[model samples]
Target: MTAVEPRTPADPATTTELAPAAAPWWTTAVVYQVYPRSFADSDGDGIGDLGGVRAKLDHLAELGVDAIWLSPVYPSPQHDNGYDIRDYQDIDPVFGSLEEFDALLAEAHERGIKIVMDLVVNHTSDEHPWFVESRSSTDNPKRDWYWWRQPGAAGAEPNGWGSAFSGPAWTLDETTGEYYLHLFAKQQPDLNWENPEVRQAVYSMMNWWLDRGVDGFRMDVINFIAKQLDLVSGPAAASDEGSPMGAQIHDYLQEMHREVFAGRTGAHLTVGEMPGVSIDDAVLFTDAARAEVDMIFQFEHVSLDQGVHKFDPLPRNLVALKRSLARWQEGLAETGWNSLYLNNHDQPRLVSRFGNDTEFRYESATLWALVLHLHRGTPYIYQGEEIGMTNVRFEGIEDYRDIESLNHYREAVEQFDQSPASVLAGVHAMGRDNARTPMQWDASAHAGFTTGTPWIAANPNFPEINVAADRAAERSVFRFYQQLIALRHDDPVVALGDFELLEPEHEKLYAFTRTLDDRVLLVLANASDTPLTLQGEWVPDDISGAELLLGNYAGDGAAALRPWEARLYRL
Candidate 1:
């Protein structure tokens, strides 16, 4: 296959004059994320499948979501959950068949909800035929398909760079006497995008899916796909600007757009998960004229409380959080777009991480929902998030299911000389397993996620935090989400308004205004356990008799906001 040259996108900083005829359909849409392994199990096989997702479509429809982003369900060895894909075009036996997935697509389309598939092309499982052929011999025909290097001096690793999961990124194959690079787990070898054959093959696979009626793709670790061909050592290897990396990534994406999605119909959504991406780069990636992607998932706000290492978390800082999100809002105000989300499959539950999840669970959950939904972007709600799901507290490391958490525990305890108790404490606070637990549907065995044993245990608090109780309660987070979704659909200002962050330096209050033409929407929330009175300057001049469109509290309080109180007003 001959590769086509792509047209470069104009610089976003100077391209503000370029504008589209109208906003896209997704600006006002809300997406729901479904982690298939934990969502529901229709076959009672201790795992969720395509059938389970099809059965739960009504729940998503009732919640008023416009789309469902399903995490990877491709065939895999289960080394890194479903991300280490062995076959790109087939479904895993554990997750049902291709026919089952087709049924799901047709059913979701019937209800006016689009289905977005998780695209994990950055790496492939070691068991994949491409990788297996490449590793068979030293001079195999497909040896250049993946990054393989000879051992360094004294038979050490190719470089000193560490894997995202832990240990050196290069794994040695005894048979070939060469090392293959894997940014994540050793079971997942990174594909060499430098090879034109590799790039064309990936594009072919993507086009196959698009032709099959899938809506779009949520690309995983997309920024890391472009690598330094020199095989440089040290931390700088992950830097943004390089020969085949950084800015060059856009070229590959542009070519992919022309090849796979040039004439695609439907309101397809494309979001790239780009870590360590700066705002300027994000602007270029999301600019409409770029044709690279619709939006990118930036990690600035989520990394505010993270220490040097991800597991070593620091205390949350409200002031820093506000500043980070504000910067993104202003950066993309003119030329680009944003993807609003608090937590996803790779992180802990948002209610437990950023909100009080205990004494004020309902209050804090609803408050966060109100603040995030009203932002000028497409918001994504993870499964179990609408019902105020809390994090799980497993007693031991053995109870965990994520490969990252298990590897960190071993290294921290044995190599770093840390105590098992201390490592377990960190895992409890920031482990991926916290987000991988079975979804809490009702107060039954295994939270009604599975009739048989669950792949991982459900949160012990499911008895009170399950969907059944929230639907019946007078004040429920699920119902609050419904109202927010409806508001976005009914009001144009919520989606097209210009964002102006107010009181960004304030510690306990998160206030912002959305202005479109003559309409102004104000969102105020007390992100703390204690009550707070709005400072005089923070209160707008048109607040005398503003209509309260939505609020978490029962009755309108006079001046002070109650604990975790959030209100949306139209002035």
Candidate 2:
């Protein structure tokens, strides 16, 4: 647990001699996300901890990732799997102690990897000290730290806002004779950013972590930092719950940057998860002027299939997915950088959801890598994604843990009047918990996760798709990802280049090119099961002699794409 200096080439200049960059650091790096519960567990506690993550530094280093974005490992009640942070500065005992976390940072840095901790600032667990005190009394100083409202006429709820999980967003506090706001679970109370002191406190906490050798942060729901002061009902969109102050969120983000992040070391990065933001709104957050975030991870493509039902469907159209990526690429090219991602803690596995995992799992996983990494954006690789992890099938509702997933199942079965079996099927299709399962390490008992019982069961496919097995195979998805990442780092065209969509009108194929100066990188992805040949006007003139850089197809370069095959070519 001792603080070890980074073993990678250290900065030649001293801290005092280092000049701060005009913009933050994340813009220039690739961040790999690690869901701690699934990442590793050194103590055999059935849950991944800091020590376990530290033990895997070699694995990450071999993969050639630049940074590690760990999901919240802070003190929490685990009501929402550490998203409900009870304390920001302390590591959750379930994950490990503060000393262990410090060791994780030191070890990760020694492997040439930066660590970006998940910053869940929008809300805190109901058990958080601040929330407990705030809820204790109406006159408490911390009472104003949270959003609390009085009862409306006839004691009806203040508004029709629904929580993201289910039920009313407002939870009545009998002790205070008022209702407090909870956008997700009642256990999580939304913080009142309108309070200047609260903002200052948050900034102080961020600086505290940064000073402790942490490189940066992957801000969770950062756009929700700002709320509408009026607390008016939000306009109905795909969901009834509107951000109370969705319009003013950016203003608060700007303030956050100016006060907390501005003029910090260039190595300090911040990637914001802003869910309902438009391209223009996204640009505002990442624009140099804003200084709030280096890049933004929007969910336009991820939510394509999530219709009126919360978690029960597949992508509606492959064309829509391509269009969404194109739109974001074009819109953010000049304004700011995009944080490209297909899999994360809150979504299902990419191979299973977008590619065919049942038949061509390895090829599909590699194809997904080629598709996302070739885009003109910094790519984020989720844990277990390189090895093609698939969705877990729960036998019944009792097997589920995610609040959102369980709530949807109840709504579908109890409220919507659907059969329990059908509801379970829908939950299996898109439950966020699918991504939350333990990371499959090996084929041993419990996926080699822990000697004791795990917090959640590991996917049964771990034996076939595991790190050890893939590491030995030259053509494994894990190795393919390494090559893909290396290409991004070595080729300037693949990194900071211009993106031009080729044959965007193709219904079953998505192809694009990245060009910078004279160098060009061409990428093609078969978004369907059937083979399709695409001829385009923008095909590189030198492509006649182009060499295959990377691909998911099984045979030689001439082999046609199976399902969800992705290819990258250098010309």
Candidate 3:
């Protein structure tokens, strides 16, 4: 298939703008991420449930998003929220019944919103029946369903690989006298995709969801499923772990497509989350003809702030950021596509990590989003991101939830020789719990997220910076997001325009241009707290008849960018 390159203008002096794409809805789609546990509580329960999300479908539809990418709501032990699945086919009671899910699908679709369910097939809950039967005895037929290895010569772990949460990835199964691998928490055991039975089981579950009217899947660690080789040592310090770049992962994905989705007639999207994936690898993963996944969530940009430590603070490298994104843009321009997001449920809030959350909080959050939506890809807006939501502020480690943070606290201090106080501060700054705070809807007690105590506390600043307040204000983040979403729907430049990074050496400014035919859209963002004079062709005098399309402040191409300001223009 030929790549769809943007049409060039016939003349350099006057560019003609192209109309919006009329096919392939996702090419310019905006996806809203709903962390069901914190979105809302319909039953007055402390925990947010499916009914809670159902009540808020109108809010999503009004936001102008094309789809909602819900986090996992499958039955689990709640060890890692719902990522550890005890049952793939049933809904957990807290999230309402399967009938309620059907209702949500109907309601969202009624409002023209597609539902992309989170698929956590990389691992299964240890409490799951398959894992239980596998652990019952070494001779059990299901024993090979999960990775089980005999102790090494010294009775050590199967290998030196480490769990993402920390420590060895293997846990001793005393009953079976073997070690089982878990890339995440011990409660979440890695499935052996090398086993054909496991492959069929996962594919069957996927078809079940599709038959239930689900739109697509946001596959959790899907690329890591094919660990076709034996577990082995990692780096000097880390333990053995599974990576998506495993040689046979391609074959597994292809086989899965042939078995599960080849005959599908509709736009059922699939996005794989690959943390360390390269652009070359991503090309194959998302190639239109390859029939694997539609796109992938790459972690290079998010990891830029961390050193070896996830909590360690490092200044954002603007030049590196530009190159990282540009490479993905160029590499996939022909064969694949991109999934754009600055923050998600597992990362720190966008405004808190990359924007100024103090005086210029509104400008910075809006600016960060300005850059995100302009990229040539499917954009994801995480829950609470639309209204400039900042990260949480918990006074003590005891107040923090999520095993990822809790485990880090223990291991970082004991094994990593880090100070307890410093680690606590780091967790406060960069922990996943920061993004998991309950959504701030109104100024009522607990942000009106629940009638009773909330599963997590709402941000204390909710009164001044929440949906109710933003919706009421003349100029608010919520309104800005709506405008951006509308622009993508109305202009083909946003969905299929060619991307060009401008001023690659600028320190405080991130500027880029998008072109489709004679029309061009220029985006200038001040990523810092200080002002920067706009330059290059984007300066008002250089481009004729440029009109400001979106901006955080009342400004133009001729005006100086205020602190943390972002502006978009069309010429």
Candidate 4:
């Protein structure tokens, strides 16, 4: 692909150029997540690349998103789908070259859209130069860049901690005669932030990207930056092998803020993927004093139905779901910002999991939109989510691609002696492959993701549920999201107002009000299949003659809400 040079900085004299005015860009900004591998493919290499993403920037801008978060395009060995970065400053060959990445940044900014790269600093690929050299010999200059330890008295692992994906977290290196820590996969070695030189290296790399005009970073597994120094194993939440390393993580984030990401100016945003963190702990990481991250994506709501193991699936509970969301809303309201999202590259599609996508997919999808966006946070719309995409079903274990999903299947079938059919059933219910399917651009072969075979199969229902069809329909979920985003940006109260839950006791209904000075916004969603009635003292007097701003149902004014129906009202 031809390299597109970065546009020259705006001139002060010729075009009446001036410094861009300061605005709370992130407050009302609608971010669209692009899973680059499945988004688009320009080279017909059966994989999406940076040039493909650049070509799709106009499509994203037209979709009404204010920003784009490109998932893990950094240089990697494709282990864990680019989450294990080999080089923070370079793009992977499969994705594109650095020049192509520069072109993508220039094109996105020229389109009035900011781009946030995925920052995977918690760990680096074992193939990374730093890790390769660090693991070469104990006394090497880069040896302390990653956590390493001598074997226990019996020549076993130092602790009982297990890898998040599977097996032991400590991987033995015969060459160095020691075990190195890896929270996820053996190929992804955890960085040693305790080393000041390591922290400085990371900070320097971050500033390099920021100075290149990249808007911000969507930090990958950010809270894991700091691990317990003592290396003592604690009681496990579920299994006896895996220990929860929560305390030291937050402390490291505080230091990250002091040394790297404080007081950055306009358009510089940072959202951290901090799993297993309490609401109080999340507040500390996002507090203005810490200044570590602008917002944090909490997994409480997503993990409600997840079984004792991460891949195990259980029946969904509406009541528990309400409580989880309410906790985060109230917990972060006073202290920090919440990053609201239901589906991402790591989870199943929201339509299939949360709502009855078989019958009311579009309505439920729009209803979820109304529910999540109305909350106090910057909303992130995953690719193909606007059209109510559903999860895919695989025939065999060979059909799966995600390492975590495959490991879970092996554990359930081989280790636990479960049937193969039963294991696939569980995987069908909850697997990362559900989100890794190719983006459904249109009904063409491979969902128009590529002229040739795609790296992964596109969702089978692409023809019926796709961007082209939704963009043409006025009542489509796509348009509903567009309207919701516009309303949020146009109304200041919706963006920065105080959020108050209305009728917290309602089991199947979730309602909230956002009030700032004289402006009041009421959001209601029926989270069940049965129709629900709006009642009680929480309904404000101002909305007694409220206008129906948006809804999934079509009818006269103040119409009743159907099953899984949602509405937004403003007075």
Candidate 5:
């Protein structure tokens, strides 16, 4: 294959290029996220790979998700679970060869399913050739590719910025005698986006991937691409949530658009993972007319359940969640789009976090599905979320593989001097490993993920929660998700309707309305295990002749909603 030539920087003279006329298919599509290392393991290497993902494409197609977002499959040191990319162009040997990746891409495209890659340009593995060269000598031509700086007074670090993995953000390179900035792990140095050379290289790599057959990208910590030029120290905090999303980010994104994505013509999808973004920031970031990013994964909704510590299980205020969702809806109603999600590789399983993981597991899973998919956004389903997967209670930290979780445990117990039991409890409650458990395909040894041991333990409840069991059951959570995906495609109101949340003050019931072209759809859900009194804005008489499009339990009255029940009524 011919290499993609580097394109010249975009001239400000022709910057006001308008987006395409019609909305693209992603506007209504539901994306399924595949954490490749945990999704499957065909090679018996105890880790999942591209060949494993290829074998499961049928499952995604059957589940009805229009696209699949496969998290970082590039060559990496497996530090931070493949996010520390060593090579931007080739498939990891652990995953498969580039030939196998090409086959997977071809097969997915042939099945009408778009493949979205996890683009990790914020940093690269210290072992990457560029990083190695940069650290080799201060006089190296590529030394400026990364953020290398001088030590502070008294041989102190460059800045007080903290690492996301619980350490100083800057690491001193002994060979160069200069510190390099790393927003996350020390092994993953932050790229200097200020360099025009760096920007050209990144844009060229993106074009190379696009020139190949992938459909889109889920950019990792994209907002952190451009940090404050001064590199000022921020307030000291235990956890480094990375850099703040600043105003300069827009300029960088616009430059990226003009160079890498300008002429794509709405054919590809882009979702920026903006950690510090508020509703106001998201408006400008995801606004279609701006051509910055097609959508963004916001952190506010997911962080609502956490207090100062992620493990402290604070009672999630239902009203606050409703209000927050409403705020984003109103903020992005005019020009921007929203990407709705409940679970992901970095987050704990939704059933355990937000829903009843025990008695009302299936019902709560179905309930949350309706609430999110019915909203005015493209819904994303994490792997095993369709089967009502729950969190695991691993007794020791040695069993966990996440860098963030392990670092937090060490910091809490060793540095901050917190109780081991309390920190362990926190890991049990909020560790990312909770969602990274091997996919439970059947009630077999190792959950049929592999005949060999899995890299991580499969959830012990696989006997009850496996996909094979759901497939045979009369009504399963998987089936409900399928219906939700189908609804987005079959019903226009589900995709483009105006959203109105009802009963924001209700503690146990989540209700909302979606209106489009005189077609009104009411989505009502009982969020708890026990039945709750149904009294709110919508009375039983409000829509006397509404058609019941879908529901989990049988009941017809405004007086009471059964436990774990939800219904979609079209009036």
Candidate 6:
């Protein structure tokens, strides 16, 4: 593959006054994620709504994020927390009416913040009208819209594939005497993308949203849209390595682009949430020439610390993490793009999972922010992450609200014969509920997230880690994030530089450089609690005259880095 040249600063007079339309806005923009159910609640309903998000637009605007990626707010039964959509074009009553959503979108655009809706097309709620019609009878016209397979001998599941949440992937529809496929929970029945009508319906829905003024879409489990129809059994060890979806994913993506996005005009950002995607696959998925998508959210870095199952986690190793991230930076350098993130709605808090959340919480949070924002990708900041929110330590299964966590607990303790305490420990460490806890707004009760009871319990540490406290402090994690966002905007190298990893084998320190022509930005981070001196080989020759752009600790030029300390230098 030929390399795309790095974008360099040009003379103002020589360049056009307006940016070329061919260049997508997301290439240099930062996106902030808001899990609506936890961001803020209005009407004292103990649940967040579009009104709540509208009320909090100022907070996002002040954060300097270019766009806001909202988790699903579509109509649903609240099964799978709105990911199981019953309606594509309407807002759920639990959230708000379409009028409220319109107001929110209008208000967000007024503040110069782009709104990116979560596009969940891999499946729809089993109660969806389409699915309802499909299951009404064997001869229903919409029956082929979803995967409906007859059971094998002894009325067993059609295949041996397991649901991501738990149990067999196929659920029997008593009315039709056939099993329908659901990769996730049974509430979310997989859509049959092989059916041209199903693909057209999805594209039509997308066009409706784009017509409604949504800036772009964050496609959910998009790669899973295409599945093998052979109904073959998967590996007993539980892996999706050779899933049939891989065979026709690109074709479907290209078709989607042509049908829904081909002639669309705007700074639209399209990102596919792809799991088990390789670097080579990502390049094809995101290459401009392919016209598939603007970018993709890859899982390589996040999967490094996982054990047998996602709930089971291994110890964090900075060397492995650095190598994983650097590989992506290099892989997507010329032909593709990367979506940089440490945590999202379905992942644990970054501070708790990968950094120190206790003694050096502030340092670790700020250091990690630098590492991610300085990378050559669009950085996505999850809600509450800017203020250093730590993972929740729910005492029992009852305290958790996520279906995935609940299902894991039941299966681990009942079928696997694992102790409740053991499963609870893993759930506390890696459960999605950790990231779903209400956003910490202030030190007030419920972290000022709601006046009524919260849908899920707030983290006990909210009082100390809330936004109000961070704003009042002289130096805080929120402020560090603000600085990083500013740096990315004011500095071109952050968005367009070529990346080179330094000391790839170093376990205690993560060092890298981003260069665009003569401008060089060197980032050195101490990934451990103990202080250590910078290794000579890791030091660049131009460091002596480089200006200190930012640092967690006060220093003019420090040879030794403090615990979890990080410094950014511009040469």
Q: Tens digit of lDDT per residue, candidate 1, span 1-571?
A: 1111211211112222222337787877788999999999999999988888999898888788888999999999999999999999999999998999989989887777888999998899999999999999978889999988887778877766578899888899998898888989999999988788998999999988888888889999898888755544433234323223444698889988998888876667899999888899999999999899999998889988888678888988999988988899899999899999998999889999999999999999999999898888889999999999988989999999999999999999999999999899889989999999999999999999999999999889888888889999998788888888877765778877899989888899999999998899999999999999866788987776888888899877658889999999888
Worst 10 residues of 3 by lDDT: 7-16
Candidates in order have lDDT scores of 0.86, 0.78, 0.84, 0.79, 0.83, 0.86
Task: Point out the worst 10-residue segment of candidate 1 by lDDT.
Answer: 1-10
Q: Is candidate 2 or 3 superior in lDDT?
A: 3
Candidate with maximal TM-score: 6
Which ten contiguous residues of candidate 6 have the minimum total lDDT?
Answer: 1-10
Residue lDDT tens for model 5, 454-547: 9999989999999899878876888788878777766778878889888788887788898887989998888887887766455456655777
lDDT of 1 at 211: 84
| Model 2 poorest 10 in a row by lDDT | 1-10
Please provide, for model 4 over 1-571, each residue's C-alpha lDDT reduced to its tens digit, 9 standing for 90 to 100.
Answer: 1111222222111211111233246777778999999889998888888888988877776666778899998888988999988888888899989899889988877777788989998899999999989988999999999988888767777677788888888888999898888989999999888788988899889889888888888999888787766553322222434234547676666676666556665557789998778888778877866666788888889988878766668878877887788788888887888888999999899989998887888878988988888887889999889888899987788888899988888887889898889788878878898988887878788888888888777777888878887878766777677677766565677677788877777777778888878777788888888877655675666665787677788752243558888878876
Off by over 4 Å in 1: 1-21, 231-245
Estimate the lDDT of model 3.
Answer: 0.84
TM-score of 1: 0.94
The residue ranges of model 6 lying beyond 4 angstroms of the native Cα positions read 1-23, 231-244
Angstrom error at residue 200, model 3? 0.6
- Candidate 3 error regions (>4 Å): 1-23, 232-244, 536-541
What TM-score fits each model? 0.94, 0.92, 0.94, 0.92, 0.93, 0.95
Residue 91 error, candidate 3, Å: 0.5
Q: Give per-residue CA lDDT, model 6, range 1-571, as digits (tens).
A: 1111222222112222233334456656789999999999987888988888999888777777788899999999988999999999999898999899889999888777888999999999999999999999999999999988887778877767888898888899999899998999999999989899999999999999999999889999999997865543432233444554647888999999999889976678899999888899999999999999899998988988889988888999888999999999999998999999999999999999889999999899999999999999889999999989999997789999999999999999999999999899999999999999999999898999999999998999988889999988887787678778766665678877899999999889888999988889899899899998865888877677778888887674367888999989887
CA error at residue 425 for candidate 4, angstroms: 1.8
Candidate 3 local Cα displacement, residue 9, angstroms: 30
* Candidate 3 residue-wise lDDT, 261-322, digit = tens: 88987667788998788899999999878888889999988888887678886877888888
